[model samples]
Target chain A: MSLLAKASAAHLAQLMGPLDSPAFDWLRTPETGGVMVRGRMGGAGAPFNLGEITVTRCALTLRAGGAVGHAYVQGRDKTHAQQAALVDALMQTDAAATIRTTVLEPLQKAAKDRNDSRARKAAATKVDFFTMVRGED
Target chain B: MYVAVKGGERAIDNAHAWLAEERRGDLGVAEMSLEQIREQLSLAVNRVMAEGSLYDADLAALAIKQSRGDLIEAIFLIRAYRTTLPRFGASLPVETEEMACDRRISATFKDLPGGQILGPTFDYTHRLLDFKLAAEGQGGAAAEAPASGAPLPHVTEFLNKEGLIQQEVASDETPPDLTREPLEFPANRPLRLQSLTRGDEGFVLSMAYSTQRGYARNHAFVGELRIGRCAVEMEVPELGFAVEIGEIELTECETVNQFQGSKTEPAQFTRGYGLVFGQAERKAISMALVDRALRWEELGEDNVGSPAQDEEFVLSHADNIQATGFLEHIKLPHYVDFQSELELVRKLRAEATEAMSEAAE
Candidate 1:
């Protein structure tokens, strides 16, 4: 999975604690925008625009290692976008291993756990139907 | 002569204030929260999401609250909000074959590969109201079942292999975005399907019902109906490969309809397809029937002149927002037009009376 895909807005918000005040320049300050959502007839059919949704995006370059990181998240949360970008930048440096384990792994686990619990609730409602064979069949 | 009515700004302001008060209802009763609507009234949210063509449950809930549970009004709110967003690049066509299905059923087959998984449907429920739900602290949790493994193959594939069903040809041409552009006449299949998916559910349902009632009748069997979450991927030009963007819940229905062979063709079953955002099986199924009915010209079927078979009629009237706007506009001042009619009647009556007096003299 891509780092961006792994880092959902909620996960990033929870994972990213206070940054160490590392020198970084704003490559692109957080800005609110919209994105057109599209869908196809079937999974692999002709595409059409569903509608547009609000999004926030930001980009930054770490002064020390010159690693650039960008983030785009749903809704108008600028601070969430900035924090996500910061995490992205740190993931490229020597702190990559630490961040992956402490931040990314935990977030992934939490997401998986939530999905599993939901599935379990749904499964409880699943009905397995059986047909009784008539004598003549 | 009629003059335009002057401002009723104060009356309008007072009306709005009264409406706001009415929207809150009895203060003794608990106020409805966005979360409660999102969780408890999820089906309404699903309908709004499907019709609004936007899939955010939270936003749908908010719209419902703001509209005071008037679903059509809620849909309008969502549609207005959706028009302001920007255009990111289109994601690759979603892979429904890999959908983690919650509900899967086939009307044609008794037992098939992946088995029929009826996930969270109200199909077999008794229609009687549950009085238990009204009592406080009477809610009970549903039993949990483990998630099934492997993606279920589509039921139509079996018919496809036998050369019985019409083949769907893959195309790379960019389909038109209905939301971004004005609708054009004689819309192609993609455009028609797009309109039908976001079209008013009740309108589409009635159109589909018309077909079953012998108006442009096409014998249709639900080949497959599946509801699940499908992965949405987008090709990142910089990354040079498509990456998983997100997953969205979808309802897909494929209908197999009987078709007679034309002079140049052989008899084979044709398909009508419907896919929409969220678990909206009724909308999806209705869309498929209406879609097939609208394809009369392409299929070489005679124009029966039925409302369902008329492309212009179905497409034009399907949108609730458009229909409601014109329907509700009757409440607006029409004094100018009414006054003209009133003058014509007066003159005609006077002429008749004058002619009668002359005859008497």
Candidate 2:
């Protein structure tokens, strides 16, 4: 996944906190719309339309470098999509290295930490069984 | 003659007002919080989530409050709200074998890999109502068991090893979504199961019961039933890998039915599967039975013309939202149609009198 794509909405929102708003033109204004969800039978079987879910998508081009970025996020959070698009555009420019270290790295670590904690909690509930050896057998 | 009734706006408004007042039921009592319903009346919230097909406990509780404890009404509210939301993507099929189960049991085996954990169930509870619960400050915390640390194995896997159960071939085809497209007749197993999972609990239970009473009877054994939370993952095409999206509570049931042997195939036990949102064992078990009954054609069994075996009948009427809408629409104005019926009856009566008079003359 692209660095911007890997960053979750929560992480991206936090990353955008200190950065000054860069001038950009809206290639596509953030719009809330429905997307059809499809599911495959047994995960590996024939696919079928599940239902429509709300999504917010936006596209923007950085005024200086003309780096275009697009983002789509689940639910109707328009600001999340806008900020995500900006991050996507920034990732393609000279600021890529700095952004990777400052934003992406921390976000990735947080996500990994969250996953590990959940796994630990679930692991606590795991059980193992063994059969008793029968003397008759 | 039936005349069209008009000017019901005032009456409708007054009725709504009365309902709101009744819902409050004396402002002297404290208003019920959504949190209370979510925590205390959790089973109702679970039922709403299962039938509604939306797994948000808070929203389900809110729906319960808004509907004045009418579960069907709460389910309808959730369904209506669900349609407006956009779907992002489908999650990877949940692995039930990896479930951190709160409840797990199998009738086929006495002791499985993971010992049967009964969890919180009303199975052993006495039918006598606990009047003390009605009084305030009478509630107490129940005992808790230490979490197990062993992974549970499926009972069907044991049969599979001995080549005694039918082999399920994995396919790459997509299943049809009942919510998006208008339901078509002669539906496949995936479509049938999907409908059954979100189907009305009472309706599905009755249909399953009918099968047990010799209507398309497929002697079923509860192979395994598990209720727990599973992680949801989604494939990111851009990233070229699937990532964990979230987790959801689910109830899964697998039933082994009667043996069947065909000309081309050997005799082996058939399987029926059901997976639903929340800890809904009854719904899941019923779903599995109905699922197995509907597999008559593929299993090379005779069509006994049973309601359980009828795919079109079961799928079409299973949804409570659709059933209630059609049932309740009778309250709407039908004067035009009723007037036409009245005119026809009057004309027929007049003709009969004229013919009688002519015969007398």
The best candidate in terms of TM-score: 1
> Which candidate number has the best DockQ?
1
Q: What tens digits encode model 2's per-residue C-alpha lDDT throughout B29-86?
A: 9999998999999889989987887766778899999899999999999899888665
- Predicted model 1 interface RMSD: 2.9
| Model 1 alpha-carbon drift over 4 Å, by segment | A1-8, A18-23, A32-34, A50-54, A118-129, B1-5, B236-241, B356-361
Compute the lDDT of residue A84 as modeled in candidate 1: 70
The 10 consecutive residues of candidate 2 chain B with the worst lDDT sum are B140-149
lDDT of each: 0.78, 0.76
lDDT of 1 by residue, B24-134 (tens): 899999999998999999889989988887767889999999889999999999888877655556666776788777777888886778777777888989988878778
TM-score of each: 0.91, 0.78
Interface RMSD (Cα, Å) for model 2: 5.5
Instruction: Compute the lDDT of residue B50 as modeled in candidate 1.
Output: 81
Across A1-137, the per-residue lDDT of candidate 1 in tens digits comes to 34444346676666666436467899889876555555555434566555444556678999998998776655567887787777778889998898788777887787778667766655554556788988895
Candidate 2 CAPRI level: incorrect
